[model samples]
Target: MINFVKIILIFSLMASPCNSLELYGKFAQGGLITGKVDKKIDLYVDNKKIKISDKGYFVFGIPRDQTNEIVIVTKKNKKEIKKLIKKIQIRKFKIQRIDGLPKRKVSPTAEDMKKIRSEGKLISKAKNINSNLNYFFDSFIRPAKGITTGVYGSQRILNGKPRRPHYGIDIAAPKGTSVLSSNSGRVILSERNLFFTGGTVIIDHGHGLISIYSHLEKTFVKKNQLVKKGEIIATVGSTGRSTGPHLDFRLYCNNVPVDPDLVISLN
Candidate 1:
């Protein structure tokens, strides 16, 4: 095993981990950072004001292609302190040519484009809700286990034509394989049918942290419902623009996509 994350801190507050401003977790491409500081201390990562839980915990995420270095600042008791975390860990994405996709999926006409735009708005609105609940501290679990087919940040070529880079991890499973919730959170959106993702479910696990599950045969939960970690929420299937039975899972922080592989352990 290799350590993909490299951490650099400007100063250490104390010998204890919980006393001063401390950042825990990996600092890499698609990495997540959870911080612990003194209560009532305001913290900002890259100038964005992030929420600090009641227990003095806050989390932030690094995007898959964040070229700029991360900057963290702390403001408390009329004093402002900042530190340069580190540069991003750039990844080499290979071109993945996926054939046998429907022509309409590859090249949608005006009518299909209309539907795509509408669904995109709905999805965006669902992910925009910044809830105050913090449930991500419990860790995440695999939604559906099988063979991994696609990875994050990979340039996808559908039918030999280049398309958007893949933003989620694709897992191949049986049509009826049960899909579990990656963490405990409230179901914000459970659209049964979408233009590209078929049945899509978006869970908000507090603050701006969210996970998306797409291409489902059926959704078991509804919007605004509370779900526990590892709860069965849907089943895998080849819906909407898919070539085979699989699930596309994605994780996001502050609405920006992050790599799910770095956030959780596969084994």
Candidate 2:
């Protein structure tokens, strides 16, 4: 009778749904996480369907100021699995005061607002381009070799006025200093004379991963161009809303802006 009961329990367990998901990488704020699941179906992060690689791999990131838990749901043929990721560490950032910004930059005129809006549309459009490339899995290199001027998540106070938290890394270099691509990607945005970021370039590194190079002195690539890792894509510049010539590098995955210093090796 005991053997019969054990056999019935084993069969019941085998009939139940199972999940064999493995997630690796940082799970804290401003961290990127890559994971693989048992089967390829549909995956949603925070209720939004994000891009998944061709090999059942998906990537996502926690924003700089996010404090809530992340929920990932995978569904296949009416069967669903919900993963509740709750161990996100909070980050404390410092406030930075800038007193030397040009008055025009700090306080943009009405015409500047129009141009800013137009350029912002272009940037947003580029970020929405999802491709099948998996180049983000490749280790990234520093976009420019320079002294680290600023970091991500730092609160920005321009001319004593509070602004958005800094979402990228700032590396100071002389004008015309070559800027390199950290990973292989297709150039999605190559704009010059933008109101704020000056000559900005954004590359799509496949699967909703994007890299941005802002305030460039010169852009060596054009829109929709393919670039390899460590290739020269731009030059350091102080154009747009900058005090000196510097490269503002940013990394994003699935619409979440993450800290490049944490993901990519700078040293």
Give each model a TM-score: 0.91, 0.87
**Residue range 69-117, candidate 1, lDDT tens digits:** 8887777664775454666767677678899999999999999999999
Model 1: lDDT of residue 19: 45
What do the candidate models score in CA lDDT, each in turn?
0.82, 0.79
What lDDT tens digits, residue by residue, belong to model 2 across residues 1-267? 011110101111123344445565555678776666545567777888766676766678888878888776667665665555556668788787877888878888999888888888888877776788888766678889999989888899999999998889999999999999989999999988888888999999888889999999899998889999999999999998899999999988877888787677322
Worst window of 10 by summed lDDT in candidate 1: 1-10
Model 1 Cα displacement at 102 (Å)?
0.7
Alpha carbon lDDT at 234, candidate 1:
97
RMSD in angstroms between candidate 1 and the native structure over all alpha carbons: 2.5
Q: How close is candidate 1 to the true structure, as a TM-score?
A: 0.91
Q: Which candidate is the best by lDDT?
A: 1
